[model samples]
Target: MAVAPLFGTVTLPSAHAQPEPPGEVVLSFPTVGVSPRLELGNNVASEVNLPLPAGMSAVRLRGVIRDQANLGAGFLEVTDDNGTFLGMVEIPPRSARPAPLPFDIDISGARPKGSSLPLQFLVRTNDIPADCGPAQQLVVTDLAAVYSGDEPSPVTIATFFPPVLQRVTVVAPTDADPSEQQAVLTLVSTLTRLYNPQPVQVRVISSPRGTAPPPTGPMARAVVVERGSAGLAVEEAGNPGAFLRVSGRGDELTAQISLLDNELQSLAQVTRARVDQSASHQLPTGDTLTFSQLNLEGRAGVLRRSTFNIGVDRAALGGGRIAGVGVNLLADYTPVAGGDAAALTVRAHDTVVYTAPLNASGRVDATFDVPSQALTQRVALDFEITYTPGQECGPLIAPMEFAVDPRSTLQLVRGGPPLGGFGALPSEFSPRFYVAMDGSGQEQLGHAAAVVAAVSRATSTPMTPQVVDVKAAAEADSGALIVANSVAVEQTSLNPPIGGNRSAIDVGLPQNLRADIADGLGSIQVFADPPRDRTVVLVTTTDAWTLVDPLFGYLDGLAGGWNDLRGDVLAAGAAGTPVDLTVRAGGSDPFEPPNVVEHRAPWLGIGIGIGLAVVAVCTATVGLLLWRRRRTDAAERP
Candidate 1:
């Protein structure tokens, strides 16, 4: 059985094939999502990027090949980020077709040479793209590794603690008719924010009566509102820490809001966390919120820094990378000669995409196009300002000051359509954030909450997921996350087109490619279908609820970002199975890949270099020649 990392749980591998040894760190996935239509012989290799487990040592790689077409005389080389040669595996001969070829032997020795963080694999062929047949494909179903190392807990305490923090469900009574959505959002928002702060999201559920609670055993959290017949009771998970609670008896939204407000105050009093009650300062979704809304100290004064999230719709761009988007900043500042430095910078994922010096005095208007590549579903804009004179300018009494108008704003130009579905995912708050769950199974709700928390962490937004049933899932107006067991999954009217005969509860796959999702494991997939123009992320497991619970950790929407999670479909293999996760990129259409492009910034830098290089060389040559002529004339005349 593959050992469970600190973050997720796993099942034992088939006795016949083992992905992880008895005790070893592992980052195993069912499929690396390498397209089968590999254009062989391009003399160029198609790269399959694989993610590495954290704090792993003495790594060894193993893979199972399901499909290989015309892969004649080609070799696969696995290299670390530094291109260090870890090892290589040769392809089989064409004349002799092999079924499920095995490359189980360790790639290198006990430890790879300079093992890097992320392992990048390059498959080089001695063939040409033009000569390669259309059916020439290479599909690797299972890629796993055994390593010697242990990582600290991957879970960070937020609303609850891990494994419970891993899954928390907010139970709101439906009889409350139009339940206090605002109050619900408030409670959800407060619970989702864990000060220790790891990008974790909490799933908020409003359930009808009679819903069975998740069976005991696995960790789970439930926050109930005591309204009408409802009552408040809390179960502490282990000895994690203390938490505040709110209780009241009323069904109206207003009453609920009051209750939630009280709850926030109680929680803040105990946790030392502040609740921004005057939400009048909270940033709005989309591009509407302005700089004035930022919670700056007494308008503008000493240095201050803050971060906020803005929701975006990538599907609007037809699921492709966007371009020509701009952010306008209106600032009013006064800069002292050299006394201190004041400026405004906008960063995306910690990289400064735009920065302007607070030069001169008065108002300054600047607009810069944020490269589409720099943006994600949950846009994080960091604002930093400093107006104090240099310590060196000390006591010299230089009237150096700076303050930005609340009118300082950000505008995302909608050049064409909306934008595009994110290549990166687990996106933050959108117009609508919904969690669709099939609560029939015991652990379904817990697994669903984990999924929602992952999204919240990824976007660093306090997501309040509107929990709905399977039927409502089909009709959600915006993006949703669906979590259910395999049987429950099949029950959902809207589901993967994997259906079998009326007598059977099996789903079919194209090209005879298959895996048993019902064999006691979980799988997750995201697609741009249903709700038209919105996305639906689905997570399902066979009967074993335990099997799917650990995946939320593997998704690591917090650390990995949506970088590794591309394509429309991803399947996590059953425990001890061949593949840990399988991804089918761009859905069925291999030509039009997912709407993500990595070729932007680096290429732009090269273009800029070339342009500057040409100008520099030309100008330098002319100047040198003119100087030489002048010197020659002077010497000849003398």
Candidate 2:
């Protein structure tokens, strides 16, 4: 079944992006875009909570239905969160034969509660009797909610969360009181969970520290956390956390990091992004799973025998294997032989996949076809190389090496039915580091580290990003996270097609944001590598270094499901609020494709050194030292 799409303003290059019929917001639920048709009890209904911006006039529900006999009469009943009848669309009771078909449902009378709406749909016996064994197997996906109108942009709990907050100001009183400060930090932490959960170098601004008044753009949203800053001598109403929404365009919400600590279900409701968190190692098929920008050190060497291990996530196998499309492990190795007789063996989960005798000379590789059923949660691949010297007792050791190129890859070519949400991004299956920039300066490094940290936390693994230059990025085969200053962006030629130079834009705004500050924050834009189909490219800037903290805060601050980040670009500055982007005139300097795979090769360097030491111990220099020590001992012998 077509699944609900992951929400995010990701701008994919035409190559990797599937051309869907144009619509405002198209979601493939479960992320992998497939849901099995399970047995739905009599009158048992399924509820799908949709993130529909205001002006969502229609909803198209697509799914598959099956039974002992394909013909089954059933209609989907639709209702609002309040269970208020919103009307239902009738099915013609057609035979849902060979495939899962799509059907549209026109909802009326009830609209979204406020930007987000929950529609409970039930596909059951419309008129037929309930048959337990011969039940109507129904599966739904690819939920497309069409919206009209361009809403004003700004940061809000809704954006930071749901019920998107438009324009609002949150003031917390503080005067060096540790408890109050701690409370504020907690509040920021919760916001970070949604906005930029990564440590993006955010400077805590007390209510009175700034030279200019708190930012209040036409559509701006600011959170001021201080001890008793709200000046509420008495108890106040609304916004459950420790703080309240002082005032803004027209939002009445209260928040504080403590709310999350306190388990404020109300606030948690708005910030639903956290629920989408999952491990990073699991990958869905089709989309490539690789890290080309991870920073790592290597340990090289020569050895008589060596073993290289790799992990394979069985969950990514999608519960079943499909023909023609299975996991493929491509291993490329360069052999540095010291002996004439050498052999190599490779295995997957203890099952020997390939074996070949090393020519005792050059590089060789073997591609392994992995069966899905054979995979487990932590399957490992072991490559063993054995070498024998022509001489039985030789003092010299050959500098033999077999280095698996970083590009040596493991890819899932999924076949068969829809696997649901797996290898899609901004989610667990997505690659970390949409873009990685060169370590040009401390500021860049700091922000880059922060992103790596965030990805690590999100994936529950130590994250390392492969930093690449604009030139290398252009040739990169996998998706990446590219970061640079405005000047660097220009040099790399990854500038946005629309809008004047985003980095070089006139420091003009409704309020004089720059009048008092040196520079504010930064911005991140995600795009597809035009040359690489299905590959995503993220562009972040530190041209205005001073703005790095704010920019980082904005992007990582908002936790939009901790999964699919909605919108094309996410930018934050001195304003401290991250907003989705609208990019145009698509163009970028594709980085080098050599890309990244974060694996530490221990034998790449000193493998021969260890063996050489054994031979070196037999040398004249070693004999001299041994003789001198023995002579000295004899002279001192009592």
Candidate 3:
């Protein structure tokens, strides 16, 4: 099957066939993290980051336009950040019947800045009427880029990762050794994090030892992980594409894989490289970090209404749990003149937390505490400035200017109860974590890789993993991803939210209940290991290991991966959709027994009432039978 690109599907010639001529490839704006719809008013411009794959040239920008204000004569203009004109689409005046208008503008001469083409869009009117309502807004939707060219083949390690990727296939031996398995899982996490927000799919498949796997599609890449002399190289596959080989044994393998680290990968300018010695990358240290430290920069805008988010990731806390959070906000804005209304509102996790007038001193300096309920693995502090000019329509009206300082500080207090369920993860397992497999085999490794990849993609930081036995991981203080069968999970010290034998299972706490579910059932559960003060994620199934496939499918189907997962348990039968089960106020402690009284009260009452009704029915039947027998005897006597 052809790999799906950001916008549409493009099929390339097979590896064994002759190369096909270059064709048009469409990339939609929304797929690359940009809004496809643009709402522009007079004199306002919006910027979009357009990704142009290597060797591909931009052809045109196509979309539909909705002229809400009925501006009779206006044209939409496109320009680069450097003020270079790209092209324009003329907007026709409203006709007898109004409808969405189609537009396609040629931008063949556009050049990319790095891997992305930065372009600005604006709608200019030929004439502005004195009675123009609401400033004449134009809406452009379904914006996409049409590029012409085939993707370039990589000759160096640095260039192997293209600007756009759909899938990555990691090939390992059917009997891969522990080191090789570790390498595969590590690479999965690395690549997933590297191409986040792109919805890239990473699959692990096994082949015979020392045999190269089948070639991948044009938009996909294949990587071979095997144990051998330490090296990382890109070798020719006798086709347009090449496969990457990461070969090493034990620590040597880890050292070689480190070459793929985001900070170090760029140094590998050649097709092949060897790492003799390498140090692990260190995460940021400290309880307080500035916006700059968290990779957030100052944002300035000239719109009447502007908004931006300040994200605080738990991974930035160096793997520490958060007990409390505080933010010191620093901002500057144009003071509102008399009769003008302007205010700045701050929201944490979408709940309004703070508000202040923006008409004083042209600056804002304030500190506020974040509510505990708003805390998660990642917290978004949304800052929005709304300014209404005093004049409805006046030439003297000045646009609002708002800026957020990068020097703003976020203070996190460590040592809180491990967050409940999936919210605790990636953060709880950050910096370094353990993967404990019931059996260190290819199947187990594949499952572990999938779990790690999904979790890694949710965070901006890299999570290091060490493969060990179940006992070692369970005894360790750090969080662990445990992949095992039902019988194996039963033997561990960790308690899962859902547990039972092959024929019966007990769902504890909030979902307090027990049932005889003979069918195979798969489950992915998270619970707090209180004694160790760590989190444990358990992946297992009741009888057949094959049943667990759907759980992974359910996770993969989620657009947000781990972030989309909720509750303490995700359980499903062999042929059913996964269901999320929450433990509620009981905390996510698996050891906590089911709330028998609370969950079973209704059932218990029903059982008692049923018994009484059965007794009454039996009594009534006996009485009626006795009466009928007496009447029969009387009739016979007569």
Best by lDDT: 3
How many steric overlaps are in each model, in order? 22, 100, 0
Model 1: lDDT equals 0.44
Task: Write down the TM-score of every candidate.
Answer: 0.44, 0.31, 0.83
Residue runs of model 1 more than 4 Å from their true location after superposition? 1-189, 194-258, 261-264, 267-288, 294-325, 332-363, 378-405, 413-431, 458-463, 486-521, 553-570, 576-638
Ranking of models by TM-score: 3, 1, 2
Q: Best by TM-score, which number?
A: 3
Q: How well is each residue in 1-638 modelled by candidate 3, as lDDT tens digits?
A: 21222222222223363432358777777555567888886657888888767677777777777655646666678877887777666665556324666656667766678888888888777766323144567888888777788787778888777777878889988877667777888889888887777777899998998787687866778888888878988888335758889999897887787777645777889988999996676776788888777777556554456677767566766757777889898887787788878888999877888898878588889999887767767778888877776677555566678877888888878886654477677788888888888872347777888889888888878888888888888888889989887787777777776788775766553434454555756778787887888888888877777767777888988867787876677766645557665643323332233452243222222221132121211234334434654655566694
Residue 64 of model 3, lDDT score: 74
Worst 10 residues of 1 by lDDT: 600-609
- Which residue pairs show collisions in model 3? none
Q: Taking the tens digit of each residue's C-alpha lDDT, what string does model 1 give over 213-244?
A: 34222233445543443322233423232222
lDDT per model vs. reference: 0.44, 0.39, 0.72
Q: lDDT score of model 2?
A: 0.39
Q: Model 2 over residues 1-638: C-alpha lDDT tens digits?
A: 22222211112123244544454444443321123233443355776555543334345433333332332655555677687665443444555444444444445444566545667766555544422123344554444443433334322233333232223343434232324433333333334333222222223443443222254432224554343332211112122221223221101111233333233434332322222222223334344443121211122233455566655433333323333223333333445345457777777767777788877346555566754433432335676776555555343545356655455445555433221111123222133333345445444433543443343334322222333455676556555555565555556544332112332332211111111122323555445434443334344443455544554555454443323343334455444545443222111111212121111111111211132121122335334444654665577689
